[model samples]
Target: MEADKYVVVMNSEEQYSLWPADRAVPAGWAVQTEPNNKEDCLDYINRHWTDMTPASLRKG
Candidate 1:
């Protein structure tokens, strides 16, 4: 089987998720960067996405 491209996505709540690179990102989700392989996407998320709380609920 061929490898699939992937994308790292994020939501208003600051949560991170993975999506198929060939597919359209769902509403309320934004692409964090250009499409990459699964491993790259996971690495990006690990480097970022430190806060899991929703922006409205996070305290300074």
Candidate 2:
């Protein structure tokens, strides 16, 4: 069996998501880190994406 390729994505809102590495990324979102397997992608997001608020809404 072949493993699936996954990439970590971030939005203007600072939200993190896992997407397929081969597919086209959606507008308003960009790749935040290198691609990895599903587990790695999830782990990275869990550790890094501590805040769920958008950049504009977060209090400084």
Candidate 3:
């Protein structure tokens, strides 16, 4: 990881800090959400996350 590769997966509206396995944690943390709706969930992450995940990579 060449820095800026930390991502956190969570489902709430709170913040926490963990030792990132790769890059430095962002302003707070990467907030992944499971919202009531699919778009809502995607929008939540899109709003708070950096577009660093490569478009061609498989997320799983």
Best by lDDT: 2
Per-candidate Cα lDDT values, in order, are 0.87, 0.88, 0.41
Query: What are the per-model numbers of colliding residue pairs?
Result: 0, 0, 0
Total backbone clashes of model 2?
0
Q: After superposition, how far is residue 53 of candidate 2 from its true place, in Å?
A: 2.1
How do the predictions measure up, each by TM-score? 0.83, 0.85, 0.29
Q: Is candidate 1 or candidate 2 better by lDDT?
A: 2
Candidate 2 residues 19-55, lDDT tens each?
Answer: 8998899998999878789999999999999977777
lDDT of 1 at 24: 88
Q: lDDT by residue for model 3 over 1-60, one digit each (tens)?
A: 333233345422343222333444455345453223444444555665454544335344
Write candidate 1's Cα lDDT for 29-50 as tens digits.
9999788888999999998978
